[model samples]
Target chain A: MSDHKILQYPKSPYLKTSYYEDTAIQAFDTPFRKKCLVIGLLFWVCFPFVASSYVVHIANLSAIAAIGAMSLNLLIGNTGLLSLGHAGFMGAGAFTTAIMTVQFGLPIWIVIPASGIVGALLGLIAGLPSFQLKGIYLGLSTLAIHHIIKYGCSEYQYYGGFGYGIVLEAPSLGPLLLAGKTVWFFVLWISAFATALLIANLLRSKPGRAWSAIRDRDIAAEVSGIDIGFYKILAFVVSSSLISMQGSLYAYYTAVVSVEEYSFGLTVSYLAMIIVGGLGSVLGSFLGALLITALPYALIILAGLVDLSFAVKEHFSVIQTGVFGMVVILFLLLEPLGLVEIWRRVRCYFELWPFSYKPLTIIKR
Target chain B: MLLASIVVLAGIYALLGSGFVIIYKASRILNFAHAEIVMLAGYLAVSLAVAIPFSAASLLAVLCFCFVLGMSIYAILIRPLAGYSVLSAIILTVAVGVLLNAVGVFVWRGEMEVIPFGWRTYFSLPGNIRLSSIEFATLGIVTLFYACMGLFYRFTKIGQQMRATAENPLLAAQRGISIYRISGIAWGIGFAAAGLAAFLLGINYAISLQIGNIAVAAFVVALIGGLDSLLGTIPAAFIIAATEQLTITYANPRLGDAIPFIIMLMVLMFKPWGLLGTKEELDRV
Candidate 1:
């Protein structure tokens, strides 16, 4: 217990209770972390200025995913809930934005918050299964809910024989019609950054510790006087709201709200982001979003540069999927602690220079 | 009478559920890619049907191929992941499913293919109820497999060994039960069941990528029946099939996909252990 480094939540003067800061995310307040954050922020801010429009587009996509991934990390990585229907919330957000904006002529500012509310409502419904179910049952129930949501979305899409999806006019938050690449890039980056910070702060708070307590052991958490059910639902609501907000922004960015785009595949990618990055860490979520977002483009570059046979080039799409699956498998099999664990090891090695310890250092800590 | 629809639909779902049940019983790892593998085997059969003439012998060969494929998948990819968390392994299966889906799109290119199953006859009963020969055969095949599985688990040496391994892997290993062989057998049978369901599905309609999504409904049925209970899928499948069939008949057919899921959620809310799932499973997680 002496080794545990509790987070200092500035506003919450009531909580003197502390828990162990066991992951890279908890070390976020360190001096080295401040330096890294500054450097990372500077790089992202200057990134669009030097990069081409295509690169900017990729960054925009990564930024949206980062926000969504970080939100999901709040639920899955921190709260220890396995939700397979994250896309349901994402789709809900997008549709809320589209319906409010297109049908009621609402502004972007109003629609974003409305979408988050819708997402939180849906999350409450989805979170119901978690109260009575655990593990596989909970996962499947979420999946079923996701399918139900998708069914509703498709019905919306095909309603009145439209034969297609809803298309939105370009989003404008007042005088600015955010159609330009540079403008979209900055707008998306700011939203994602703010989301990351918001989640980080929440994770360092009392509710965060309560969520963690429930995650480590629900029975024990209940005995410790935490309202396990309330906190669990709260985790879902907060995470789902943020995720839906990302979805709404995505709709505005793409200017389209198609049900087909929000499928199980989309959910899988978000899960991949959190798992590959480090489930509970905000930085891991960001890293995962960037990696997964850039993965396809990287594969395309590799394919184009290599003088592969025409047949191989034609089948590159499936090959890329195989490569992606293999990478995830390797991570799960070899490094279950994820990239956050790898990052910790690297930092420790540098700090200890000549006396870097082995995996057993985890226990010694 | 919609009894025909219920019987045919539930039979297929029952087969699909067994695929989930067997692997879960053996390894305790939920294979999210179960349906995808099932879809792949169906595609394999369709491809073979094109190259070689369809016959009972050919069907057996295709199922055998799927069994081998399943064994290798477990041996090569999943076995190495035994050291990781159950959630992580399950996530890996999700990745595998995505990859398999990509392969389905790559190989078939989204076109619907039919396995020339060569069984097109339908037997009609009183009251306008009709059963396609393939559906009838599927019902028979599933029943036979379940009966055999029951006997195997109750009376055979390997069956007892499998039970031991599933109950306590570490203790079973010390007691001379081979986890490798039991897991292999479980995956093989599970894949075989999936292949049979896929084959029947292709014979009834056309095989398409959407088959995987429909097969996902099987998970609902299985969970409601009980994840670990081998025979529990029967009653759960019937309940779901009846509900879905009624929904299709009385309501907008579009809601058919949501019916089973709704039932699953309802069941989970009331009886989380399922109809026959052991009460202790709630604590295992």
Candidate 2:
């Protein structure tokens, strides 16, 4: 308790809460939280200008993935539910948007929301079983959902005739063109920012607290009078919506929606992003997506610079996957909280400066 | 011929499904890397066979290599991550699988290799039933492996320890058992079984980087059989395999992969713990 209180500044009115209080640190008056918000906003504003075309592309991709990862974190990280089939929800959104735009000639505004709604509806249906199940059973249930979606999309002729997937034209906002890397960068960033803000605000609300409670200990949360069923479904709905949003964005960015793009491998990659990002942390999701997405491209460029053999270059894809695995394992073994936690530590170190002490007591404090 | 081929495929599924069940039972984590281990073993066997002068010698060498590889994986990966969150362990195993797949692709350059198992003969049976030499060998080897496992568990002291650990690891530890050692042996055995299955599969089909996609059937089989029940795996594997074969042969060839997944979904909806899995075992952790 003393250690928890040590970081609190007595002069700050925001620090008056007892250290044992279970409420999240929501008081924005605190210097740390304020600084973080300011820095984040500044970065968002200037990101497009400062970032190179390749960097912008990576950032856009990361932003979309971040939203998806954040959504998954809500279920897995917050609610303690493991879902192996999230790509199904993303696929639902992607395919829905793809179908609407290509087949039905729907406008982007109508299609995007419809895609999210479709995703939420499917998520609700998939998550309905969670009310009766727990743990691995729940995980397997989601996995089933994943396979069903994959097979349904691939084998069935309803969405698109066999062997042909839906493709969309580049979107435009009224007279303003929203195409290429530049438009996608802005679109994904705005969506990512909105998602982050929504999640951050939700964390401050009662429902979010309920979700966190359910995550830490569902029995205790149930005992505390939280409707376990409602919150659990809500988590799925919200998370699925975000994932679907990402899916819609992904479809537009790539302009093609193929079963190959939404394979189990991609699901694994998304999970890896969440793990490497830091499970429950919003910032961790962004960091993890950036690392996982960029690492391969960076490695490929390095390999090219060294004039690697054709065989080696061909194999580099697998090697990249291996390195991703190794990074994930190393992170789990060394810092389970992930890169976000490491970043926090680095920030704290700089903030504390020369006053940092290495003694057990000081370190713990 | 198709029916016979279906039976052989079912037999292959049973082999892999049993391995998955063993690992899941002894250590309550789905080894996402299980398929990768199979791929690794297949590649290893092919590489070793190519290097060796004598075929029998190469087969023996491959088996020994698989055993050692399995043991090392347990020691290096599973043991350290013991007691961590099941989710973390699952992800870690998946990561390891990715790593193995990467290494395999890096070494093999993503090429499909034709493994020559030195058997091309087919035996005819009643009602147009015909089985290839490799299929017969696979079925025989699988039956022998299961028989050996059943006898080993029934008769051996280490086997009893494994059962105890699987039943209740904490309680087994209280009874002077080294749970870590039991878990290691379980992983070692599980990996070796996967290796054997991969080798058999490679003999029938071409081995490549994408062999892991085929191994996804193991999950459906494992689920249908009850992740904890060895006996259930065989029947479930056969049923799923039969469904896949029938769908492919009659309905649509493209639906072959999708059929197992459909069965998996149906099973999960109706009996999530599986046919043989008890409520207590199913809900643990």
The candidates' interface RMSDs, in order, read: 2.6, 2.9
lDDT of 1 by residue, A84-164 (tens): 889988999998888898889999999999999999998999888788877777877788788788878778777734466
TM-score of each: 0.91, 0.92
What digit string (tens of lDDT, one per residue) describes model 1 on residues B1-285?
479878888888888998888888889887789778877877877887777884566678778987997898889888887765567878888888877877777787766888776656879888888887777787888788789989999999988988887778899999988898899988888888888888878776777878886678888877888888888999988888888889888986778878888888778788988898877787766
Model 2 RMSD, rounded to 1 decimal: 3.9
Docking class of 2: medium
What value does the lDDT take at residue A313 in candidate 1?
A: 80
Whole-structure CA lDDT of model 1:
0.83
Which candidate number maximizes TM-score? 2
Q: Model 2's A-chain: what TM-score?
A: 0.87
Q: What tens digits encode model 2's per-residue C-alpha lDDT throughout B128-235?
A: 888888889888999998998898788898888988888888899999999777777777788778888888888888778778866888778998888888889888
* Candidate 2 Cα lDDT to native: 0.80
